[model samples]
Target: MEKDKIIKYGSLTLVAIFILSTLSLLFLNSNPSVNPNNSVLQGYVIGYAKISSYDKVVKVQNPTKELEKLLEDLSKNGTIVRSFNFENELVIELKDEKDVYRLNKLFNEYNSSIFADAIIDFENLTFFDDSGKQLSIPNQRKKQKITPLFDIAEPFKIKADAIVGEVSSKEPVVYLLSISLLENEKIQIALKPKNITLISYAISLKIPWDSRSYIYDLSSKLNQSNITNKVNLANYLFFNSTPSNTSLSQLASSNIPFISKITKSTISLNNIQTKKDEINNLLSLYNINVIFPDSSIEIENLDTKNINFIEGLVSNYSNLNISIQKENLVEVEFYQESEYGSTKYVLDEDKLKVRFKTALNPNDIKNISVQAEVVGNKIKDYKIQQEQ
Candidate 1:
């Protein structure tokens, strides 16, 4: 009987061992086993979506083989792990992060490596995830989030001091200013006239002893809370002193107005007209003859916003006689050292001309001339010249 009991217990222990082994095997299978192929999903990137404008939902005739080969070549040392279709775009992934810049360059340089007839906007492409959500090229999709160095979200942060001067042998209080980017590839600049006020329009209001006389143009540029980087400034050349033109002078003259703080970022400048209606309304006042210097800047991308402010003045008090001069203004900037810092520009189209008309009268003429002078409340060691 004792021998039988020992044998029975040994048998029971063997059964228990078998059950434990079976359970272990099942657990291993249920849990995720390490797979070598899964590493491809780790640091992947989605290619920019290229879409058709006329037919937004038009699918590519042959997407997989031709497009796939081009993307693989663009990713440098990376490989195309997987791809799928989302709407009309071919969503693709690259296994390496180092290929981000390479892909961008390739997308721009060669729209299609194989198919010459393929038209693609490689910069802006759309793709969707498993959840049917939109997935754009990472980091670069939100262009606004990425601000180049010294770019202000609000342009008004730059101290915009007024350089009140006269045109070359021209009359009326002319605002002569020149703006340039100065090797900074992040910021944009513009100039638009706001209005003029007559403290004593002997010929034109004399640049008062108070440095605050330049406040009108300053406030117009740097007075917005959240400035949309769009400076739709029309020909700041006005012929009359109406509400828009006259009110600027009388608006804020005592001190330099404060504009809200701004953050910097880049944006597009297509289909934007600087001076549309404002120019038309003023056109009714006079036959405008404008001379735009044949100078243009070629931009790489639409990363910087375009802004414009007028660069002239208003005077109903007298026939003006003012002598103006020109400087090496192929590039210029009216930068003010405000509390924040100096404003930067990627490019500035800052050429200006000032002219006003009145019946010629010798006594009515005011003998005053101006040079490019930077005067404002924010400026130090400078004062507006008082009339003698």
Candidate 2:
């Protein structure tokens, strides 16, 4: 009897273990955890949906409370939310990749359409998962893939016209016009004048101060052109602003007033002689002959010795009048004279101080030439006056 009871208890324990294992398997299938590849399904929430120009709303119904809540949250985030039950579809428009990924993950985890027996439609849109991996659905209405509006070989052109009123306000009244080529066809857009303000606002946000002035100037020109189209304004502001390789010839042809003011402040030299000497010294350092003298003074040749003679003279005579002349040869002239009536007998004791100017070149000096004659107590002045 004891052996039989032990056997019965062991059999019951084995049966209970089998039942628990089966329940675990069923639960795993019903609520599966995210896989490594499908990890993007986590931490994302629906943002919103937008209906394109080609899209039409047939009917909207939100049966699942979860989907309804998701749509409400997305609508608050500036997305156009649309739901249609007759077509058995839930369409959500997203602002950016972040929102698109969020909604995609929610749909994957909830198996949204599978549970609701509805279809998920992404109209005129594309999506990427959290890892930047593309998510493609099978057996859905084919979305028309829009090639970028502008071609790779062309860039968007911008043009505007405006009239400046005599009012105190700085705002420029504008008239805007724009045209774009799509699928090798030209499309003209019309924009109202008020939209010009929006374009200005966007320009101020994106462009620097200097560039912003150009855009503002364009706005003023637009206001003056008498443009009555609002669609043109939107196209020029948003579509043209994006990166493109489209030809902007038409946009460039529009005339706009752009003014650039460059103010330059002038600096005047207080002492002309000092400035001339300084400039000569700089020139001499480059092995260039800039100074030629009217008279002769025996000094070390600068070309042979590479010695700076003008720099030494300026250092010695701080108030020396240094003049530069360009004739058959460059000349540096200097002179100083004293007036006197008293006479001394000794020629050497005459106490005559002769001031002479010297000319030197980086090349060989063949002979010295003096153009002025010196009288008693006076040296001839051959100073060449330079225009300031």
Top TM-score hit: 2
Report residue 308 deviation for candidate 2 (angstroms). Answer: 34
Candidate whose lDDT is highest: 2
Q: In model 2, which range of ten residues has the least summed lDDT?
A: 10-19
Residue-pair clashes per candidate, as listed?
22, 35
Instruction: Give the least accurate 10-residue stretch of model 1, judged by summed lDDT.
Output: 10-19
Give the per-residue lDDT digits (tens) of candidate 1, residues 1-388.
Answer: 1210111010000000000000011101111354322311111112222211111111222344655677556445545443344334454444433333344445445443211111122222233333434444334332211100111111111111111111111122211111211121121232222222323222112222122223232323443532223222211111111112122111111122221111121111122134333433442354432222222111111111221111132123112221122111111112333221121111112312212222323122222111221222222221111110
**Model 2 has how many clashing residue pairs?**
35
lDDT of 2 by residue, 58-94 (tens): 1123337776776787678766444333224343334
TM-score of each: 0.15, 0.19
Please list the C-alpha lDDT of all candidates, in the order they appear: 0.23, 0.26
What does candidate 2 score in Cα RMSD to the true structure?
34.1
Candidate 2: where is the Cα deviation over 4 Å? Answer: 1-65, 73-97, 109-388
Off by over 4 Å in 1: 1-61, 77-85, 91-333, 336-388
